[model samples]
Target chain A: MDTAAQPDTAPAENLSAKVYADLKMKLIVGQLRPAETLSIRTLAEEYGVSAMPVREALRQLASEDSLIGAAKKAYRVPDLTPSEAANLFFIRAILEGAAAEIAAENVRAKDIKFLEKLVQDMDTAWQNQDAVQFLLVNFKFHSRIYSLTGNSALQSMIESLYARTGPWLAHGITELVTIDSWMGDHPAIIGALRNRDAALARKLVEEDARWGVDLYRARS
Target chain B: MDTAAQPDTAPAENLSAKVYADLKMKLIVGQLRPAETLSIRTLAEEYGVSAMPVREALRQLASEDSLIGAAKKAYRVPDLTPSEAANLFFIRAILEGAAAEIAAENVRAKDIKFLEKLVQDMDTAWQNQDAVQFLLVNFKFHSRIYSLTGNSALQSMIESLYARTGPWLAHGITELVTIDSWMGDHPAIIGALRNRDAALARKLVEEDARWGVDLYRARS
Candidate 1:
């Protein structure tokens, strides 16, 4: 499913899918701001592709509720209210916590080592105050563990959740809290995973994911 | 979001949206078969619409992973492997359990009465051995409680999970087990809610949701 390694196909179709994937990632990583309007012409120009594919991708994401669209109008990233934001993190806490519990059951020494490296890198990104890099690396850190669960559907659902939070997190961290505060829970989570304590891992991950609600509250 | 009451739009769009909504409901209620390939021509004829709108709806559902699609081919419902099916139910256990806990906090006397009515209706459906009606009413029974949480995102996530399970469940209940086994847990769940015992509600709901895995196993 990595577009880079996939075989070639019709140019237009590929461009639309590529744009969709790229935009989904950007939305997940907070590359775009919440409530920001996305003009097809602007995105096409930005990606150096035609407007048609950008439009298609926007429609697709809108259907997923990650964006707001209307007939012949530009798409806008959905802006969550404080309560809506809290509800989202609440659901994430349950889903991702369950994911962590499953991941702990499947953890291996090498997997722990890999997670450790990502944690260290996340710390480095935090120390350097590279919010965007920190966000992307933080994504990889969690994705590694979710992948261990061997449930693509769970991983996909979790990923779609980021599309709603990414913009808010990307913006909230800059003004409300340091990246380290959010990163603080990662080490303990890794420890629980290393010990193969599924219950503890679930608890810690739930604790870690609860920061999203706090972030939303602080911003409000 | 209810399509029936909305003012009509362009005929093409109305048809497409109606098809999409209808298909989504059918999938949720186990009216479709897992891994069953759906022909656009046949569906268009079934719905008495043009193939173009049917094709568009199929593409939309396929994007959502309720159906699988390839260019110039019919879309097939995803047939999950046993492990994959178990994982789906595992995630649901967490999500729905969380929903029930929250619903307990928000439950009113009238809400309990409403839920009791649903439980009775589900029992009636079981007495009639109406697998399809049982599935549909069970959806409403769970949905009534989940709606109490006022978390649209959680409800949406739970609903999407149904799309993946419905076809299999519909098939399984008809052949593997009767509807009563699954209905056994509902009354206790209602009691937990009536008592406003959040923890008990969560535990009971988790226990109920875990039935999906058992259902899948019996068939396998």
Candidate 2:
């Protein structure tokens, strides 16, 4: 809530762009709560800019469905509904599964190493009880695989889905932390990628997404 | 290009909503050309509204990726690119296939009949060389199946993808008309739904999406 902007070093014209990017990141990282009402004046004051940029940023986010437009010049993060979460899980399964399948065929040894290192980082975060770091690293892990498809459009679509789900995931990080066997299939997924078993990789990725949904449901 | 608004019969506050919905429909039906520039002032003048609503509509469309943001207040439909189109096709195949698979399990007898009637209508359009009607019917046919899944989120996501690809599909309708077998797998898809064969339905839907991509590539 105290996400005050540091001094605005960005150019005048890019002020709105900077505000948009910052707010988008906040939504994606789950720093903002669901159903949280956001006032342009408040965000503008917090971000050390005038209300104009904040207004534009809110409009953009509302357009993306990351934020819901309320009354005039007011916006709120969409409240998470169980059905909406389930639908997003179904979609993530399809998209991430497709990405994993394509990446399996195209994955390089270096990519494997990169993902392995991320898993290691996530493990460390888990052990240290750093849910935030764990969540961030977990995102990077999947994003890397999706990026291997060499399709920016696909990556963007997948990322947008993540943005929609991230707030919920963040809210449920406590439950995620309690699950001892979190990311259970990640190693197998990596194995499939290493072996170039596209089908197995896809299946594992889909299952992994479904498992997240299960976790969310249980916690909710 | 002369998509002027008839009159503002809708309530005053809902003018922006109306503009957004109208522009969205135009995008989905492929009435707008890819890469065509859209000016807020011109649109406002045409729609018989202030520039505010038109600007908002453009922002919403750009957020959905159906249109590309150019300058501060300018927008354009995203130009068709082979790779972007191919990526969309792959994603659509995965999504539509999943929708079909789920719908196969949940589809009612009435849903099957509805789809059958649509296919018959499309056949007539095809026979009459009414490319526009054929394209519209083709969309409704697939949309009907996706709706049977009973997942509004999935339907919305699928619809957004259609919005992105619709202009390209519209541009390629002539070539689609020339093709002897435009919807080769639709009957099989309907048959799978009738029989509740989820796997076959999924496969057919995916193949149908891929075929559309092939047609687009050929035509473009």
Candidate 3:
């Protein structure tokens, strides 16, 4: 989903999307917290744009559940508990699974090679204890597969899920275990894609979601 | 999805959700076409409200893909072709299937009894050649199952899909065949949920999506 906030023909849209992407990355990187409010005035001044586009970006983020919008109040980041994150991840898994099923049906050798490179990079990032690098690469891996589906609505839904649950995904991921345990499904996904095993690909994508649930349960 | 726009604690939120729901029904019933632009001013005037809530409603619709937003232009109903609708339906089927799987695990006797009554009503609607009645009941039947999932994110995702493809669902539905042919899966779904067969429920839900694809392919 990191297509670099490609601009639409409209300048307003470009600005809105730019603001949305900036806010999204901040959410993903744990720069924003649920307690803080995102003021249209502040964001407008910061982006050096009118309040209109900033307002639009806030509305879009609120729609995505990335930001909580209260009546007559500024939007804020949504504070998601682990269980809540698990529930969100449940939808994400089903969607990513469906996306993988589509990808498996249409994947090419180059796609497989690209995915393999990501898996390697992700493993390297994990080994280096770089959660940020690992997650960035991890998102790219999933994003590539989602892109292969060519469903913008579905893609946006997954991206929203990613953005909405960004902090949850970033939180304590490295605490769970080494890269082998967390990144275990990447190899299987590659194998399933290579074999064009839609069901296997789907199952594997879904299977990967269990870690978050188990992580929550294990602590409980 | 058609549960009368539930009012929130915030008056502004209630008004926005109200406007969103009204516009959603219009989209579902095909009162609005893709050619007509949805101006915030016109909608605000129609609803006798200020421009802010109307603007929020339009942006929400645009986010759900029920409306198309171009840069510096009013939002318009997205013109979806059968093929495009089919693609969207593919994702819908997957998410709905996941929802059904959850429902199968939690569905109760009373829920089954209620669904049975709806099925009977749906059959009667089909027998009377009432597309509107049939669709309303059909949506209710699915909504009940989705509600049992207790997953609002999943519920909203499915709702967005339904809204986004409302026109497609309304187009040429009865043209395909008799009620028995189209509504054949309702009984099987009931059985699967009653038996708590999560896998069967999921499969049946997914299978139901094939009809739309088949109908489109047959027409092509």
Best candidate, lDDT: 1
Error of 2 at A172 (Å): 1.7
State in Å the error of residue B71, model 1. 4.7
Ranking by TM-score: 1, 2, 3
Give the distance in Å from residue A171's predicted Cα in candidate 1 to where it truly belongs.
0.9
Point out where model 1 deviates above 4 Å: A1-14, A40-56, A70-73, A177-179, B1-16, B41-56, B177-179
Query: Model 1, A68-161: lDDT tens per residue?
Result: 7776577899888878878778877888888898899999999888888988888888788777777777777788888899988888788778
Per-residue lDDT tens digits for candidate 2, residues A1-220, read 3541222223334666677766766666676778788999988888788987787778767756778885574688887787788888888888899899899999999999999998898899888876657766777889899999987767767776766777777777765546766667888899999999999999999998887678876765
TM-score of chain A of each: 0.89, 0.87, 0.85
| Model 3 stretches astray by more than 4 angstroms | A1-12, A34-36, A127-129, A174-180, A217-220, B1-14, B34-36, B127-130, B174-180
* Candidate models: Cα lDDT each: 0.79, 0.78, 0.77
Clashing pairs in 3: none
TM-score of chain A of 2: 0.87
For residues B28-90, write the lDDT of model 2, one tens digit per residue: 667778888899998999989898878777776775688987557568888878778888888
lDDT of 3: 0.77
iRMS (Å) per candidate: 2.7, 2.6, 1.9
**DockQ for each of the predicted structures, in order?**
0.49, 0.52, 0.60
* Proportion of true inter-chain contacts also present in candidate 2: 0.64
